[model samples]
Target: MIELGKYAGTVLAAYGVSLALLAGLVWQSIVANARARRDLERQEKNG
Candidate 1:
């Protein structure tokens, strides 16, 4: 890895935070999709 010298800790922390946020967004999307699909199926069955 390239040397980040004196700012390595700060840079790494920023990267970690960004990756975590991205993961959370992806997880939220998946959960939302599943819920919507289930609701749609329920509605169809009821109808």
Candidate 2:
């Protein structure tokens, strides 16, 4: 593993928060994309 010295806690916390935010962003993007695809399919079928 990597050592972070005296600032390890602060550094690790920052990384944890960043990782969580990124994960949430990715999840939202996937959901939104899927919804858009479904809407497009419905419109195409009705048109």
**In order, what lDDT does every prediction score?**
1.00, 0.99
**Candidate 2, run of 10 with poorest lDDT:** 1-10
Candidate 1's clash total is: 0
Stretches of candidate 2 above 4 Å error? none
Models 1 onward score TM values of 0.96, 0.87
RMSD (Å) of each candidate, 1 decimal: 0.5, 0.9
lDDT per residue (tens digit) for residues 1-47 in model 1: 99999999999999999999999999999999999999999999999
Off by over 4 Å in 1: none
For the record, the alpha-carbon RMSD of candidate 2 to the native fold, in angstroms, is 0.9
Candidate 1 global Cα RMSD: 0.5
